[model samples]
Target: MSPENNPSSGIVSQLESWAKRNINPLFSKDTWITLGEYIGLGRPVSNRPITTARELGSFVSSRSSHVAQSALYGYLKTRAGTRFPELFENPKMLASINLAKWHIYIACISDLAAYMGVLLHLRTGSDNDKVVRLMSRVVDDIVDEIGMPDEAGDDFHESVEALKIRIENMDFSMHEDGDAVFSVSPDALYKWSPIADELKRFDRTPVKNSVRFRWKDVRETARNLFDAQAVIESFGEPGSSGSA
Candidate 1:
C-alpha cells in the first residue's frame, strides 16, 4: 500500500508535517536519520544484529559516541538558527533552549500513541502522577540515549524536578477555557495542544508527502512495531516496563 494509505505511515506523516510547519521547517531526511542514530534507532557500524524487539531495545539503550552526540547538537542548533550551548552545559535551562527536540519527542510520542494510550488506560492508580513520571522518563531517556555526561545526571534530575514543581503550581482556572496551562510561553502553549491531540489519536488519517524513509530498514521496523504493539495491547495482558 502507498504510505499515504497506510495507517502507521499516516500518523508519522502528520507528526512530520506538524514539526515542519510549527517547530522546524528544516527537519529533513538527514535530520530524521540523524535523530534515529542519535536515539540508537539505527544499527551501529559494528555489524551487530538487531533481530528482535528485545535486541533492538537493548541496542538502543547502549551509549552512543561523542561524534554522534555532537552531530545531533549541531542539527538542533542549525534548526533553531542559533547555538544554545546550555543544552549540553546546563539541564536547568532546557526549555529555555527552545530547540526542536521537545517537538520531536512530542511527535514521536504521537506516533506511539496507539500503544501508549492503551497502556495508559490500563494503569490502575492516578494517571496524572504517571504522566509526570512519563514526562520525566522522556527527558531521562533522551538524556541517557544521547550519552550525556554521567556526572550531569543529578543536574538533569534537578531540572526535571523543577519542571514538575512548576506543573504542580500551575493555575488552570486562569484561562477562560479552564485548560491547564504550563509555565512556558504562549507560543509553546499553542504548539503543544495539536501535538497532544495527535498523540490522543490511536488511529489517525493519512497525509500525502514526498519525503522517503531512508534510515536503513530499522526505520521501517520501528514504525511497524507500533502496530504490533497495539495488537499486543489488545490481549489485555499485563504491561511490562521499557523505554521508547
Candidate 2:
C-alpha cells in the first residue's frame, strides 16, 4: 500500500486516539475500553481492574473475530501493564500478565491473518513484510513516547547482547546449549554481564566514568534475549488461546 493508502489508518488512527486520551499520569479505564467496546465483544470493562488471565481469557472468549479479540486485548493490555514504566508505573503485576497475554493474542491473530493470506508474515524468520510490519510500525508509534528506540545510539546492540548472554547464561539449564549459569540477572548485571568477558576476551572500549546506565537504555535491549519468533510461536495457531 502507498503511504496515503494505509490500510491500518482507521484502526491505527483509533489506537492513536486512545493514546492521546489516556496520556500518562491520568489514565481512565472507562476511556480505555473505547476500542474494545467499539468491537462490542469482550466483557464490559470499567474503571475497575480486569485482574486475571481468566478474566482476560473470558473477555477474549466472549469476542467474535480473533482479530477483534486481539485488538481489544491490545488496548486493554496496553493500558493494564507496567511493561512501559513511562506509560504506567509499578503497575499491578496482573497488568503485565495481561499485556503479555495481549501481545500473545495479537501475535497469533497476525499469524492467522497471514495464514489466511489476509495478512503476511504469518510464519517465522520471514521479513516484516510478512505480517509484523504493520504491527511493528504500530507498536513503534504506541511505544514511541514511552521508549523511543530511535533516540538511542549505536551503543545499544552490544549492550543488548551482553544483557542477553547474562539472561541466557543464568542457570545452566537455560543455556540454549545447556552450557552455562547466571540467573534472574535483573536489569543491571545483565548489561554488565559482558564487561568481565569482553574485558578479558577482547580489546573492548574502556568504560567511561561518565557513562550513566538507564533502564530505558537497557529494557529494549533486554527484550532481545528471547527468541522473538519462539515467543510468538508459543502462542500461535488458532486453538492456542492465551490461557496457560
**Highest-scoring model, TM-score:** 1
Tell me the deviation in Å of residue 121 in model 1. Answer: 18
Instruction: Give the Å error, residue 160, model 1.
Output: 15
Can you tell me which runs of candidate 1 are displaced by over 4 Å? 1-75, 79-87, 90-92, 95-104, 115-219, 223-234, 237-244
Q: Please, what are the lDDT tens digits per residue for candidate 2 over residues 33-75?
A: 4443434433343322223222222222222123333333334
Best by lDDT: 1
Give the TM-score (vs. native) of candidate 1.
0.25
Q: Give each model's whole-structure lDDT.
A: 0.33, 0.31
**Predicted candidate 1 versus true structure: per-residue lDDT over 82-177, tens digit per residue:** 223223334444433333333323223222221222233343222444433443343344445544334333344444344435434433223321
Error at 6, model 2, angstroms:
1.9
